[model samples]
Target: MEKNLRLRKNEDYKKVYSRGFRFYNKDFNGLCLDSKNNGPRVGFTITKKYGKANMRNRTRRRLKEIVRLNRDILPNLDIIIVPKKHTYTMDFNSLNDSYLNLIYFMNKRYKRK
Candidate 1:
Protein backbone atom coordinates (compact mmCIF):
# COMPACT_ATOMS: atom_id res chain seq x y z
CA MET A 1 0.00 0.00 0.00
CA GLU A 2 1.12 3.55 -0.58
CA LYS A 3 2.40 5.63 2.30
CA ASN A 4 -0.33 8.20 1.76
CA LEU A 5 -2.95 5.52 2.25
CA ARG A 6 -1.54 4.35 5.55
CA LEU A 7 -2.28 5.54 9.07
CA ARG A 8 1.24 6.54 10.15
CA LYS A 9 1.17 8.50 13.37
CA ASN A 10 0.73 6.95 16.81
CA GLU A 11 -1.97 9.51 17.51
CA ASP A 12 -3.85 8.47 14.41
CA TYR A 13 -3.97 4.86 15.53
CA LYS A 14 -4.98 5.92 19.03
CA LYS A 15 -7.78 8.08 17.67
CA VAL A 16 -9.21 5.19 15.75
CA TYR A 17 -8.84 2.75 18.61
CA SER A 18 -10.49 5.08 21.09
CA ARG A 19 -13.20 6.68 18.97
CA GLY A 20 -13.87 4.30 16.11
CA PHE A 21 -16.26 1.41 15.82
CA ARG A 22 -14.55 -1.97 16.16
CA PHE A 23 -15.10 -5.44 14.79
CA TYR A 24 -13.31 -8.61 15.90
CA ASN A 25 -12.90 -12.11 14.56
CA LYS A 26 -10.81 -15.20 15.18
CA ASP A 27 -7.84 -13.80 13.26
CA PHE A 28 -7.99 -10.04 13.57
CA ASN A 29 -9.55 -6.88 14.98
CA GLY A 30 -10.81 -4.06 12.75
CA LEU A 31 -11.20 -0.49 13.94
CA CYS A 32 -12.74 2.18 11.73
CA LEU A 33 -12.94 5.93 12.22
CA ASP A 34 -14.32 8.52 9.83
CA SER A 35 -11.59 10.15 7.79
CA LYS A 36 -11.19 13.58 6.24
CA ASN A 37 -9.50 12.17 3.19
CA ASN A 38 -11.34 11.08 0.09
CA GLY A 39 -9.94 7.58 0.29
CA PRO A 40 -9.49 5.08 3.05
CA ARG A 41 -6.26 4.81 5.04
CA VAL A 42 -5.13 1.65 6.82
CA GLY A 43 -2.68 0.44 9.44
CA PHE A 44 -1.66 -3.00 10.61
CA THR A 45 -0.49 -4.09 14.04
CA ILE A 46 1.20 -7.44 14.64
CA THR A 47 3.00 -8.26 17.85
CA LYS A 48 5.75 -10.69 18.87
CA LYS A 49 3.13 -13.09 20.19
CA TYR A 50 2.20 -13.77 16.58
CA GLY A 51 5.79 -14.72 15.63
CA LYS A 52 9.24 -13.41 14.75
CA ALA A 53 9.89 -10.42 12.48
CA ASN A 54 9.57 -12.42 9.27
CA MET A 55 6.31 -14.00 10.31
CA ARG A 56 4.83 -10.70 11.37
CA ASN A 57 5.96 -9.08 8.14
CA ARG A 58 4.33 -11.85 6.15
CA THR A 59 1.09 -11.37 7.96
CA ARG A 60 1.21 -7.62 7.32
CA ARG A 61 1.83 -8.18 3.63
CA ARG A 62 -1.10 -10.52 3.37
CA LEU A 63 -3.34 -8.07 5.13
CA LYS A 64 -2.17 -5.25 2.92
CA GLU A 65 -2.94 -7.24 -0.17
CA ILE A 66 -6.38 -8.02 1.11
CA VAL A 67 -7.03 -4.35 1.75
CA ARG A 68 -5.73 -3.35 -1.66
CA LEU A 69 -8.01 -5.80 -3.38
CA ASN A 70 -11.02 -4.54 -1.51
CA ARG A 71 -10.29 -0.84 -1.40
CA ASP A 72 -13.27 -0.06 -3.57
CA ILE A 73 -15.61 -1.58 -1.03
CA LEU A 74 -14.01 0.27 1.89
CA PRO A 75 -15.23 3.75 2.62
CA ASN A 76 -13.24 6.90 3.35
CA LEU A 77 -12.09 5.95 6.84
CA ASP A 78 -9.05 5.34 8.95
CA ILE A 79 -8.82 1.63 9.56
CA ILE A 80 -6.51 -0.23 11.90
CA ILE A 81 -6.10 -3.98 11.66
CA VAL A 82 -4.74 -5.81 14.68
CA PRO A 83 -3.85 -9.37 13.89
CA LYS A 84 -4.12 -12.30 16.29
CA LYS A 85 -1.71 -15.22 16.54
CA HIS A 86 -3.83 -17.41 14.35
CA THR A 87 -3.49 -14.86 11.58
CA TYR A 88 0.02 -16.05 10.95
CA THR A 89 -1.21 -19.44 9.87
CA MET A 90 -3.93 -18.27 7.53
CA ASP A 91 -3.40 -18.38 3.78
CA PHE A 92 -4.07 -15.39 1.56
CA ASN A 93 -7.54 -16.43 0.43
CA SER A 94 -8.69 -17.16 3.94
CA LEU A 95 -7.26 -13.93 5.22
CA ASN A 96 -8.94 -12.00 2.44
CA ASP A 97 -12.28 -13.65 3.14
CA SER A 98 -12.09 -12.94 6.84
CA TYR A 99 -11.11 -9.31 6.32
CA LEU A 100 -13.90 -8.78 3.80
CA ASN A 101 -16.40 -10.21 6.23
CA LEU A 102 -15.25 -7.77 8.87
CA ILE A 103 -15.43 -4.88 6.42
CA TYR A 104 -18.98 -5.81 5.48
CA PHE A 105 -19.90 -6.08 9.13
CA MET A 106 -18.31 -2.72 9.84
CA ASN A 107 -20.24 -1.08 7.01
CA LYS A 108 -23.51 -2.47 8.28
CA ARG A 109 -22.78 -1.38 11.84
CA TYR A 110 -21.71 2.09 10.74
CA LYS A 111 -24.86 2.53 8.69
CA ARG A 112 -26.97 1.87 11.77
CA LYS A 113 -25.28 4.64 13.71
Candidate 2:
Protein backbone atom coordinates (compact mmCIF):
# COMPACT_ATOMS: atom_id res chain seq x y z
CA MET A 1 0.00 0.00 0.00
CA GLU A 2 1.07 3.60 -0.46
CA LYS A 3 2.93 5.24 2.42
CA ASN A 4 0.36 8.00 2.77
CA LEU A 5 -2.36 5.42 3.23
CA ARG A 6 -0.63 3.20 5.75
CA LEU A 7 -0.80 3.36 9.54
CA ARG A 8 2.96 3.31 10.17
CA LYS A 9 3.49 4.89 13.55
CA ASN A 10 3.43 3.02 16.84
CA GLU A 11 1.13 5.69 18.31
CA ASP A 12 -1.31 5.21 15.45
CA TYR A 13 -1.62 1.51 16.10
CA LYS A 14 -1.99 2.11 19.80
CA LYS A 15 -4.75 4.65 19.19
CA VAL A 16 -6.69 2.14 17.12
CA TYR A 17 -6.11 -0.65 19.62
CA SER A 18 -7.17 1.43 22.57
CA ARG A 19 -10.08 3.40 21.18
CA GLY A 20 -11.25 2.15 17.81
CA PHE A 21 -14.52 0.40 17.12
CA ARG A 22 -14.03 -3.31 16.50
CA PHE A 23 -15.42 -5.77 13.96
CA TYR A 24 -14.64 -9.44 13.71
CA ASN A 25 -15.10 -12.81 12.05
CA LYS A 26 -13.78 -16.32 12.68
CA ASP A 27 -10.71 -15.52 10.58
CA PHE A 28 -9.80 -12.07 11.88
CA ASN A 29 -10.65 -8.91 13.81
CA GLY A 30 -10.69 -5.31 12.61
CA LEU A 31 -10.21 -2.15 14.61
CA CYS A 32 -11.39 1.06 13.00
CA LEU A 33 -11.25 4.69 14.02
CA ASP A 34 -12.35 7.66 11.96
CA SER A 35 -9.46 9.03 9.93
CA LYS A 36 -7.74 12.26 10.90
CA ASN A 37 -6.02 12.53 7.51
CA ASN A 38 -7.21 12.94 3.96
CA GLY A 39 -8.09 9.27 3.47
CA PRO A 40 -8.26 5.88 5.09
CA ARG A 41 -5.11 4.19 6.40
CA VAL A 42 -4.50 0.54 7.32
CA GLY A 43 -2.10 -1.54 9.32
CA PHE A 44 -1.67 -5.28 9.92
CA THR A 45 -0.28 -7.05 12.94
CA ILE A 46 0.49 -10.77 13.18
CA THR A 47 2.01 -11.79 16.43
CA LYS A 48 5.17 -13.90 16.62
CA LYS A 49 3.05 -16.49 18.38
CA TYR A 50 1.31 -17.10 15.08
CA GLY A 51 4.41 -18.62 13.43
CA LYS A 52 7.94 -18.04 12.27
CA ALA A 53 8.78 -14.90 10.31
CA ASN A 54 7.96 -16.42 6.94
CA MET A 55 4.48 -17.58 7.84
CA ARG A 56 3.63 -14.28 9.49
CA ASN A 57 4.89 -12.39 6.49
CA ARG A 58 2.83 -14.54 4.15
CA THR A 59 -0.34 -13.95 6.12
CA ARG A 60 0.37 -10.21 6.25
CA ARG A 61 0.89 -10.20 2.49
CA ARG A 62 -2.42 -11.89 1.86
CA LEU A 63 -4.30 -9.38 3.98
CA LYS A 64 -2.46 -6.44 2.44
CA GLU A 65 -3.23 -7.59 -1.09
CA ILE A 66 -6.92 -7.88 -0.30
CA VAL A 67 -6.96 -4.37 1.10
CA ARG A 68 -4.99 -2.95 -1.83
CA LEU A 69 -7.45 -4.40 -4.31
CA ASN A 70 -10.42 -2.99 -2.42
CA ARG A 71 -8.95 0.31 -1.31
CA ASP A 72 -11.30 2.41 -3.36
CA ILE A 73 -14.35 1.09 -1.55
CA LEU A 74 -12.95 1.46 1.94
CA PRO A 75 -14.35 4.21 4.11
CA ASN A 76 -12.23 7.12 5.32
CA LEU A 77 -11.02 5.55 8.55
CA ASP A 78 -7.94 4.17 10.20
CA ILE A 79 -7.99 0.39 10.30
CA ILE A 80 -5.88 -2.36 11.75
CA ILE A 81 -6.46 -5.98 10.73
CA VAL A 82 -5.47 -8.70 13.16
CA PRO A 83 -5.70 -12.22 11.85
CA LYS A 84 -6.55 -15.28 13.85
CA LYS A 85 -4.58 -18.52 13.83
CA HIS A 86 -6.93 -20.14 11.32
CA THR A 87 -5.62 -17.88 8.55
CA TYR A 88 -2.27 -19.68 8.45
CA THR A 89 -3.75 -22.77 6.81
CA MET A 90 -6.58 -21.11 4.89
CA ASP A 91 -6.48 -20.69 1.12
CA PHE A 92 -6.28 -17.24 -0.38
CA ASN A 93 -9.75 -17.26 -1.92
CA SER A 94 -11.36 -18.17 1.38
CA LEU A 95 -9.19 -15.68 3.22
CA ASN A 96 -10.20 -12.98 0.81
CA ASP A 97 -13.86 -13.73 1.34
CA SER A 98 -13.45 -13.63 5.09
CA TYR A 99 -11.62 -10.33 5.00
CA LEU A 100 -14.28 -8.81 2.78
CA ASN A 101 -16.98 -9.97 5.13
CA LEU A 102 -15.18 -8.34 8.01
CA ILE A 103 -14.92 -5.10 6.04
CA TYR A 104 -18.62 -5.24 5.24
CA PHE A 105 -19.34 -5.67 8.88
CA MET A 106 -17.18 -2.68 9.71
CA ASN A 107 -18.93 -0.50 7.18
CA LYS A 108 -22.35 -1.38 8.49
CA ARG A 109 -21.45 -0.98 12.12
CA TYR A 110 -19.22 2.06 11.90
CA LYS A 111 -21.47 4.09 9.66
CA ARG A 112 -24.44 3.87 11.99
CA LYS A 113 -22.65 6.14 14.40
RMSD (Cα, Å) for all candidates, in order, is 1.5, 1.2
Per-model TM-score versus the true fold: 0.91, 0.94
1-113: candidate 2 lDDT, tens digit per residue = 68877999999999999989988899998999988999999999899999899999999888888888989888899999999987999998999899889888888879635
TM-score of 2: 0.94
lDDT of 2: 0.89
lDDT of 1 at 38: 73
- Model 1 over residues 1-113: C-alpha lDDT tens digits? 77878999999988998998888877778889999777789999887887899998888888888887788898778999898888788788898888988888887787524
